[model samples]
Target: MSAKVPASPRFAYKGDRLKPLRAFCQTARLGSISRAAEALFLSQPAVTLQLQALEREFGARLLERSGRRISLTREGQELYELARPLVEGLDGLDGAFRERVRGLDAGELNVAAGSSTILYLLPKIVEAFRATHPEVRLTLHNVTGAGGLDLLRSDAVDLAVGSMLDVPADLSYEPVYRFEPMLITPRNHPLAQKAELELQDLSPYGLILPPQRLTTYRLVDLVFQQNRVPYTVALEVGGWEVIKQYVAMGLGISIVTSICLTEADRERLATRSLARYFPSRSYGVVVRKGKYLSPHARAFTELIRPALFEREDYYANGQSER
Candidate 1:
């Protein structure tokens, strides 16, 4: 006969107490007992009681009330800082658990990307992933490259995809592709007839440039700075698509990545190689250090890795072998 085994001690009550802690944190964060109550679906008195209980447990006043307003005490501020992540992590855990119960892969994969990735790459990548794992939902946060990296560090996003320039040391990156930048102008523009172009050659025309913070803008700036080329920037826009649209309208000449130009753009505009060598920008996948990746996210990464880089090399090398 098998020996009888002792059952584990009950820990459910301890875990369930997070509900009160969550309510207290929300009230502290929002600085209004009524607002916090509404947010947590509890009465004002209930939220007040929870806050009082938390303060009692810590043996200090956590909040101070003045008329209709509330503010955190010094100790409360510290506790609030600590509690915010705990609450967020618990929420993430709840989401992961629900997904698991629904016969789907658990955990969320938050992706941060720029407008270029959203417009050009993300749709195809997301579609392909969803076809195989229809139930795995992906959340995309679109921001500038710098902002994307900030989100990744803050745990707002699991991964970021874009140009790899000025990446932070705490993150890891895998190169996806290297794209050549091209100068685009209206079909009737004088430079359209040129076989090749340089920034100095295009100095006579107004240039529609991206904002200073964007990787594209930095790439263009580096080239001009290195070559000592002087030109007039007619406009500075935020996104590639917008820049292309402005260029198409004969607004001004603009430099853009070759991949950002579509067939429609080609038909409407003329593109020329820079007379001097402009450095190609490497777009890559970026993830935070030591963060957990869901199985579905890992699979998606595997799919994108080959689709973006390896297969192209295989075919190119194969043709050369022939």
Candidate 2:
């Protein structure tokens, strides 16, 4: 009698290799096998076995474990970087295929933006998008910059719309709008009376600024420090509307992006361009480096700015500054 062939090892065949790779990618991303297992709905031992299988298949040690922390080795890092996009693409294939079949007539598009952007910048564009693609389910997530970035990275949102002071390596920012910085004070305040104002002139008046952790506060701090101008904060609060209200009440003067300014605001508060002191803020679309845009997403982005991703070198530069 012929000897029977031994059963093949699990995930040993080329076609079946995706299983191990998926496990490894998830583990690397979470930095913990247990968390990866939880995300993948697999047992910890199973995930560990899959990782081992992947390492063996590639003939390289792919992970280094210390206490509760797990990190990728040099070879693992290189492999993870190369394989992540492929894995992500594969993982999203079903949804992408469905979106393609549905076309722009139907599909969900999630966009993340801050309150100011939702209030001022996106109103017209959003209205236009809804008019064109009323059937598409569009969800707008109002979140801060850091929160928006987190959502973008986690694939919770298809794109983010807002101002970015610094661009990360794994993300691309393409600016579509620019607004000058402005200093606002009560209409009758001393600074508002002058046709021209100096930075030092405002030092005596207390400033109403956002929280210290926000970009606006930091930018204002940086400018004053560089110019050696001493300043004080009269109030720390959130939201441009609240700040403007406080300034109008003569609590203190404030610096704000012109994006939030309106004709009505001018009647209550005297506004002067602070472009010389602060850089103009640019608002745009931010996306993960290798994110695949769906038909609904593409349609919405096009409404914001035509051909937003036509160029292949779009991500080559961190951002296009105007």
Candidate 3:
């Protein structure tokens, strides 16, 4: 009798080899097999079998269970970080391929930006992008603070264009523009007429500023505190336009970023460089660490700054830093 042929390892299991990894990934993410099963449309038993096969294949425990909850082991966490992007990329491959074929003529791009960025920084970029890719649907989420970060982490928006003083490890910030810190007051204000301005020079005046929660307020406070210069906030408001208007109406002198200062603003409000006392604010593209940017998203970012993320590592491992 002829010797029995050996079974090929590749065909040992049915369907895609990726099924086990996908199952494992979902289970690891949801932390409950039942929830992962519900998400994957597979029964809990099937998911369990897949996980078992995956652990056997890797010869390491990928997960640990206590009661009904689950968590990844150290090995599992490392694998998750490496495998997640691959899984996500494959899952999006079909749509991505279609978009590639159709080009920018058909697709949607979502961006998150605060009101100031949307108003000042993105206008020219948006106008140019719209003129070029008018058919593409673009939505800008006007968000700030934690809201914008939440959208980015959830992949609700493709990327964010705004200022970031503190960047999280899971996100990447590429600051392309830097604006000087400026002190804005009504044209006739005494502080505006000073040949030279010092941080202590404005301590007597109550300042009109954005809410204390904003970075501007915190940065200003930090500087003043560092110098032992006491300052006061006369009014807490939102929006650059509103702050400039309030300052123009002589409510109080305010410290502002030059990003929002225009020719009209310069005419209405006398502005002096506070760069000596304050650091320049940086604005740029913010993306999730391992996000796969759609072509529409990539195109929009290119308009903001040419050849942005052209390096392989940027879209590849999402490890690129600027």
Q: Lowest-scoring 10 consecutive residues by lDDT in candidate 2? A: 313-322
The candidates, ranked best first by TM-score, are 2, 1, 3
lDDT of 2 at 180: 78
Using all chains and alpha carbons, the TM-scores for the candidates as numbered come to 0.65, 0.65, 0.64
In the range 72-125, model 3's lDDT, one tens digit per residue, is 999999989988888989999999988766753477788999999898778878
Residue ranges of candidate 2 with Cα displaced over 4 Å? 1-105, 305-322
lDDT of 2: 0.84
Candidate number of the best TM-score: 2
lDDT (C-alpha, whole model) for all candidates? 0.74, 0.84, 0.83
lDDT of each residue in 253-320, candidate 1, tens digit only: 88876557554665787777553457666677888989776676687776765555532432121111
In candidate 3, position 42 carries an lDDT of 93
Query: Lowest lDDT 10-mer window, candidate 3?
Result: 313-322
Q: Could you list the CA RMSD of all candidates, in the order they appear?
A: 11.0, 13.1, 12.7
True lDDT of residue 71, candidate 2: 96
